[model samples]
Target chain A: MTDRLEAQFAFLNEADRLKSVLRATTLCDASRPENSGEHSWHLALYALVLADQAGPGVNIDRVIRMLLLHDLVEIDVGDVPIHSQNGTAHGSAETQAAEARAAERIFGLLPGDLRDDLRALWEEFEAAETPDAVFAKSLDRVQPVMQNLACGGGTWATYDVTFDQLESRVGVKIARGAPRLWDWVRCKVRPWFG
Target chain B: MTDRLEAQFAFLNEADRLKSVLRATTLCDASRPENSGEHSWHLALYALVLADQAGPGVNIDRVIRMLLLHDLVEIDVGDVPIHSQNGTAHGSAETQAAEARAAERIFGLLPGDLRDDLRALWEEFEAAETPDAVFAKSLDRVQPVMQNLACGGGTWATYDVTFDQLESRVGVKIARGAPRLWDWVRCKVRPWFG
Candidate 1:
């Protein structure tokens, strides 16, 4: 019992480091760069509040779970802003590899059953195959774009993220999850890169 | 179409403010004050990761929803800290009333159906009724105590919180949600207040 309790605490304590993993985009109010912890919370809220925007047969509860766990790996790999100078996901191949390893060490803090369950969920989001994953991935992409536009082109300006670049990176996944929102966002952000 | 998008954007923008509403508790890392947004995220993770601690038949999904939306009202009423100077919930009747009104206005930012759904969830948590709310409230009580212990009495030391006071306030609720955890935590934190 003592051993098991200690294991859970270890994971929760490690989660504190997430608040320090800064992203590229600033808060919409432009205070400072939002951390992964806060970003996940906002994304979960989007999952709840924007359930209507999701396609038919999408399971909102499952989508919320994916969003909550998605960027947790950022705690270990660290976050590379969507529009970093490199403009890559979690930085690059090296960081991606780091994230994969971090996912193990971090989620491994759980008991065996939970570790397996969460690792599968994390992989599900990465594959973006299921309806839930598609929706969660779309919300993940949607948040930074909103932050950029709300901050008057936050990361977009910093990274020189052009429309073509933006569309290629986020367009397909965003369309898959919520086509109408993807279309509307395109019109809203067209001038940022131009 | 624009109207719906506008409503969502407005709500999302408002949520950014939650990141600024810092709580009395420090991160287990003892870095800076943890903001309500990040704290809520941590709590949701607790809901998912610690669901086993909850009693049988408790809906983990519903509990997670309750945790996610719980502190959002603090954007309006602001946080009073579980172990604040007064060592009370929101400090005063006036403050509690303010939080109630805040819950309505904050959750009301969603489109009609979502607004009602979320407002109800927020209220359910406050009432602490049903299996889900009881389980959610338990996780809520559990996090801060763990934070204080991990930080070697972070906020507990500053506030000079005594064991009796802590027990009187949070003991029963914590026991109700996860009895084994509560029992372990009591032994873990007894030294802090003693």
Candidate 2:
């Protein structure tokens, strides 16, 4: 029992590094770029506030869990912005390989059952195939777009993001599980890009 | 549908204020005092990482949801640290009233259903009655103790906290739902206090 508790604490202590792992998107207040830890929290709040718009059969409870766990890998690889490297690294095989290894090393800090449970959730999120994972991914994409829109094209202007890129990279994934939210984002995004 | 989506976005945008709401506890690295946003995120992560310690009948999914929503009232009332104001405001009647009003206004930013759903989760956390709420509240108290332990008595040194105060104010609550965690904390905390 002591060993189990110590292992759990070790995993959590490692997670603290997430606070120092900054993301590219600026806060809505435009104060500073948000850290991965807070961004994941905001995304969980998005899961709660916007669960109504999730794809049918999405278990919002599970969706919320996925959002909280999804970004833990960024603690190891740092964030690869969707537009960086022409967004190639965003889903490249190499990046995926690095993240999978990070998952093992980090989640491996816990005892067997927990490591498996958390790693499985992380894997499910990466797959983005289940209804819950689909909705989780949709929110993951939509949040940055909303943050950009709020701060007057926050990262969009930073990356000189174009409408075509937004459509191909962000819009389609969000539309997969949350058509209504995607529609709203599209209307808001058009003015900024135009 | 458009109106509902807009309302959700408005609530989310308003929630951006949380990142600015600072708390007394510093980050584990002692870089700066942690803000309520990331603190809540850390607590949610704690819920995920330490779930094995939860009390019987504790539904960890709801516990995670409750933790995410718990401190949001801080966005309105600001954080009343457990050691501040003789710790009176931590759960004082006036504080409860202020937090209740804050809950209505903040959670109210969402449309009716989402608003009610989130507000109830927040209330469950405040009441701390059910097994899930009990475990959630245990984590809510334990995190700061762990943080203080990590950073060489982060807040305890600030407030000149005493062992009796730690026992009365913090330890009992954690033990209620997670006795094992309290046992672990007691050991680590003893060396500092002694």
Candidate 3:
């Protein structure tokens, strides 16, 4: 038991490797940038507090799980911002391959049941057909918007972003997942545009 | 506008510094391991999934918020493992002082309403009087146990922990926040003890 415990600790110790990879990939305020761990944590909280606001009857727990594990694959494939016009092309295959490797290495540290459960949750999130996935993606999109607003147009300024681009990035998810939040964003951005 | 944006970006960027401080303080499993970001994210998800199991009338949103922000102060005072023999010896004055500093630095970044809201949530969580705080703490305590069980006695083996120690650390919160979960733990751990 002690020897097995030691072996497990070695893997847990490398958990920071996930953080390191996240830090390398994500941008903090769209401009300044942040690590993946912070992004994951913040999104998890969003999934929790705002779950009720999700399209009715969404399973928030599953959404939270999805949010936490979603970017973890970035540990290998690296973060590819959904809004990156130029960077989006041809990245999915490589990213998918990287994520598969990351899921195996990271989730493998846990006992069998947990490994399977978490890995399945990660896969479910990627598929994004269920209520949980939709809500999780909504949280993911909203988090960056909140950061951008708080940071005074973080990515908007950095990318010379137009209202059209912002709308396109966030509109669909917000409309589908949390219309109230979408309304809030629309109201909030209108003043800036004017 | 640029000046305001830069200021906000600086605030968001400081999240890295906070992450570093939390990494230094909290244990990943039990024996002073894993980064703080992981702990925060894990607990948030735990709160989300277990919301249905919380004592009757518990506000799931508030509980989730508390779980997310409770440890942000670890950014300043660092993680004080409740199970540690040293925990009882630590004075509240040190923790309070650190919390004050952390609250100011971290929450000050957001615009007015958000800053106040998050800061208040953090303080409320620390006070632990509200139902949200109680359930939040329960989830916090339970997450490590789940992780340990998954990783085959994570901190229990590393620290040579006893059943008594585990109970002393987690008992009260479990009793108040989620009695059923406590019962489940007892059932699982009883065999290990034998």
Q: What is the TM-score of each candidate against the true structure?
A: 0.95, 0.97, 0.60
What is candidate 2's lDDT per residue for A67-182, written digit by digit as tens? Answer: 88888888889998899877787889989998998999999999999899989998999998899999999999999998988888888888888999999999999999998788
Interface RMSD of each: 1.0, 1.0, 6.7
Clash pairs of candidate 3?
A22-A36, A27-A33, A27-A34, A28-A33, A28-A34, B27-B33, B28-B33, B28-B34
Q: How far is A79's C-alpha from truth in model 2 (Å)? A: 0.8
Using lDDT as the measure, the top candidate is 2
Q: Which segments of model 1 are wrong by more than 4 Å?
A: A85-92, B89-91
Segments in model 3 whose C-alpha atoms lie over 4 Å from true places: A1-11, A22-32, A85-91, A190-194, B1-23, B26-39, B42-67, B73-194
Instruction: Give per-residue CA lDDT, model 3, range B1-194, as digits (tens).
Output: 33343343344445534444443223433444556666676566566445555877688767766766777766666776554553462336766787789789777875555568778988887777778888887877766675666546765665566788778766667767878777766666656545
TM-score of 1: 0.95
List, residue by residue over A47-81, the lDDT tens digit for candidate 3.
64454467777877667667767776666667776
Clashes of each: 0, 0, 8
CAPRI classification of candidate 2: medium
Q: How much of the true contact map at the interface does candidate 2 reproduce, as a fraction?
A: 0.63
Which candidate has the highest DockQ of all? 1
lDDT (10s digit) by residue, model 2, range B1-194 = 88888898999988878888999998888888888888888888899888878866888888888888888888889999999876677899899999999998998888898888889888878888889999998998998888888888998988889998999999999999899889998987988988
Model 2, residue A90: displacement in angstroms?
Answer: 1.6
For candidate 1, the per-residue lDDT at A78 reads 77
Worst 10 residues of 2 chain B by lDDT: B51-60
